[model samples]
Target chain A: MGAMSTESDPLSVHDQVVRSTYACIARFGMAKTTVEDVVRESGLSRATIYRHFPGGRDELLREAVAWQIGEFFIRLADHVEGSADLVELLDRGIEFARQAVREHALLQRMLVTEPDRLLGLLSTESTKTLPFIAAYLLPHLERARAAGDLRPGVDPVDASDHLSRLVLSYIGARGVVDLDDPAQRRDLVTRELLAGILRP
Target chain B: MTPEASPDVRARLLDATFVCLARVGIAKTSVDDIAREAGISRATLYRHFGGKAELLEALGQRELTRLDAVFAAAVQDCATVGAACSVLVVEGAEFLLDHPVLGTILAIEPTAITPLLSLGHADAFLTAAAALVAPHLAAHVDDDAARLRGAELLVRITLSHLQSPNPQRSITDPQVAQAIVDQYIVPGFVGKSAIERIQA
Candidate 1:
């Protein structure tokens, strides 16, 4: 839950390294962030950092990205918490996802400062992120399906995968619908997402 | 590559770009590499394109043009826009996934391609797709705007699927891809009555 484990425990060195790598990504973007940068931020020596991540800076960076995305999903779940209306909840959740991706410290930095680095994170690296996100979304979709919100014969797994793909599409390319308009956003969900997957 | 000098010049440059991208990838792929592969000097390459950026843009344009033509041909024989929508997504997904140039670039260096995949280009892609699909939709839908709207949503959904395919389901699966078109895309263009009639 915490970004960093307490420094009092030396055994939490891996967490410290990961936290430092995250900070370095936020500050310098992923392309420029080096193992030395993580070492400097975490106050760990090069030997210790290398011991934790034998693959070096890229390994550390990937772990840091995973950590950041996990934190992001937690915050998103909290934001979409307690909504009784499934459509509204989905709309809000998707909007939150869009803003979260657009404003993510690392993603924003990469888009503005080091765009080439952002590509791998979105493309191939997405092999990891997409499944992770779908897993996070599955429970909610299953709940909706159980409530008879989804169409008959619609698999919850498929729906969740579809939703995740939809969200990623928005992140990479804005939809034709205006996301800024709550009504339009709701229309997109009801028409594009819900109608497509839900009972007609 | 083509008969006319201008067309030949463009085709050669794009082909060379694809070759370089397939071989060395986008980051290491320079104008010089493309020129060398095309059997032309850098000066000749420059005469055709303003710079590397322009060349890259031209390649993107050529790719889209080819895609548009494919979609047009795929949908031309369909009796209904709803049917065309189904064929378009399935065939389009196949084309994108099986495309040597696109698949190779996305596989080897997705990071280099992300910038071009931004929201700014989504509009262009949607518009191009709509232009090809609208004629088919127009034959079914009375309202021109409604036809265009349906095509836009269809393009949006297809693009999302192409970008982030379900890990479990194959994009090449006709059953799954057809279901997406049936559930999501068709109803927007054809009325519910028509959909039922078509399905029946």
Candidate 2:
């Protein structure tokens, strides 16, 4: 196959590598997403990947994860921005969150096998989504408050961090979902989210 | 194996668990710990509470009940959604930190952190906390959405803070943390009351 880059290549050589890495992850996850798999999926030789990325598979995965993180955040922000009500904002947010937790095989692998290490990742900014939660929502809270929609005294920024960590916790539930009925488990999560704040 | 006897035995075992927790903490406080602390034989402890998991749930349930009482009190006077929520969330955090038992639990058994972080049963705490917020939110506020989302965020950040090697231990000021939260999170819920209210 011969394709020209002309100006905008929707998927680049690097992009293909990243995508292939993720494809392998989809099949074998972060641990098993080998260079051979990437090479086979990508139609690129292992030598070529090594030439580009000396660090090999871990480096490829790091980039893949970083790219995935950015894309996921963008989508999540769009969901948050689309809603007005506090409840709705969180609802959409959780939906995106559920999807992320359900789909991200690598994150799940880390959560299951290496929680403390994952927690350490959360503690720092290398791969944390916590830092962005407030930054994403502060504008909306301010806008809502001015519109008299937001109740008095709610600190939007602190609330964001507070909420970010909470959602992460939900997404990180260990083996409970994999071992149980996935849909029923998801419903239980949805129920907990809604029921947790329902008025008596 | 009868349900009635099982629960009673579970209760007695959990009560004994508190003594073990107080003395050794959750990690070191194994099945033997409960047995020895309760003056019950090891076999009896196993009969009621299968192992660490069951012991943890029993303890978590007890702790949730304790939190429910304080949380209900904190938000009792919330006239607006903001007041009802802020007061409740902060008070809830305070209660979590105040309970040496919880601290002991976390310190003793770090993985147990997952129960609150990942499991659905913890919604009891979320619901109790939301009782404070439900009144102040817009009448149309989605209870299901808000509680679920809020709990998700709240659980992660609160646990992170608690588990932090050194969280903001000495600021003695919510305002500082509030500023962080506002610059970061509030705008999503209230459109700009915090920023707009300032007279130029």
Candidate 3:
């Protein structure tokens, strides 16, 4: 079962391995996916994958998760666009998160088939994820702070962590809010969240 | 006498559900197993609970009741919105995270339980959690719906942290949890100056 590749460049093999791992998790779940599946999916030899991820399956899975999150944040930045208005930014962030959870292949598979595993990783590894997200948000938050959009005494690091946690909570609970309606999403994010940190 | 709708039966069934869940997890714990564990016939189990879903729902409610008691006690003496909410949020997170049944379900059966965390249930929980702090909030913030909104935010924040805690931060630690509440949560209920004054 060789992966169909349009490009044979050396760097693409790394990308191919990561993508294959993600697809295996999406199809088989964390508990059931094996290194052999990654090898088969990627059309790469087991030795090659082991060379790249010496820790084996777990390492590959970890890398895959990081890659997926990295890509997600990039898309998130585009949608949020560093809005000066915290409320508007939060509204957009919530919308993007809801859609991501619903549509992201990896996330949907994880949520449906191995939610506990996903939650376990999130709870334990979120320390890594939080800083990663906060760093991504640092620039946006700093820009907002400079524009005087944030309330006095708000730290961008703190704000990024707090906002990231807020978004993660909404995403995890799934039923905490009606993400279906755009107006309601704005109202909840603004009234419940932005009001606390954003300038009046 | 096997009274079909006895509280004793409900309690017995819930206890059995906990034992089975702890041992084999939600995916493996079946209605038949619960009934067998409770030493009741399948007919009796069905007589009490419509099915496995109904029984699990009841288990969730039972856990919420236990949590409500913890939250009620935690906020009993607090006078201000921030004071009551910080205590409630911090204590609630600890209680939920430490509770054997809920913690196990969250760790092992996350996918099946997402719907249980949905907005409707969360709103209901928030409304209940807020009612405890509403009187205190009323004495402080004159704005209508402030207490309800604050409760929702507090609960959401706590839920988020519990679900996906920062790797570097310990939500279970009182100092860390309190600081987060102080920085991100308190200001939502009280104005920024109130937090500033308290900090100063």
Best by TM-score: 1
What local lDDT does model 1 show for residue B109?
65
DockQ of each: 0.42, 0.09, 0.20
CA error at residue A4 for candidate 1, angstroms: 8.3
Global CA lDDT of candidate 1, please? Answer: 0.71
| lDDT order of candidates, top first | 1, 3, 2
Model 1 chain B: weakest 10-residue lDDT segment is B114-123
Q: What is the TM-score of chain A alone in each candidate?
A: 0.82, 0.58, 0.78
Task: Say which prediction, candidate 1 or candidate 3, comes out ahead on lDDT.
Answer: 1
Reference-based lDDT, residue B161, model 2: 61
TM-score of each: 0.80, 0.48, 0.70
Worst 10 residues of 2 chain A by lDDT: A191-200
Residue pairs of candidate 3 with colliding backbone atoms: A127-B167, A175-B118, A175-B119
lDDT of 3 at B167: 71
Q: For all candidates, what are the clash counts? A: 1, 42, 3
Please identify model 3 stretches exceeding 4 Å from their true place. A1-12, A21-41, A53-66, A81-92, A95-128, A142-153, A170-191, B1-7, B27-54, B106-148, B167-169, B172-178, B189-200
Off by over 4 Å in 2: A1-24, A30-67, A75-127, A136-200, B1-12, B19-29, B43-53, B72-87, B98-111, B115-200
Q: Is the docking of candidate 1 incorrect, acceptable, medium or high quality?
A: acceptable
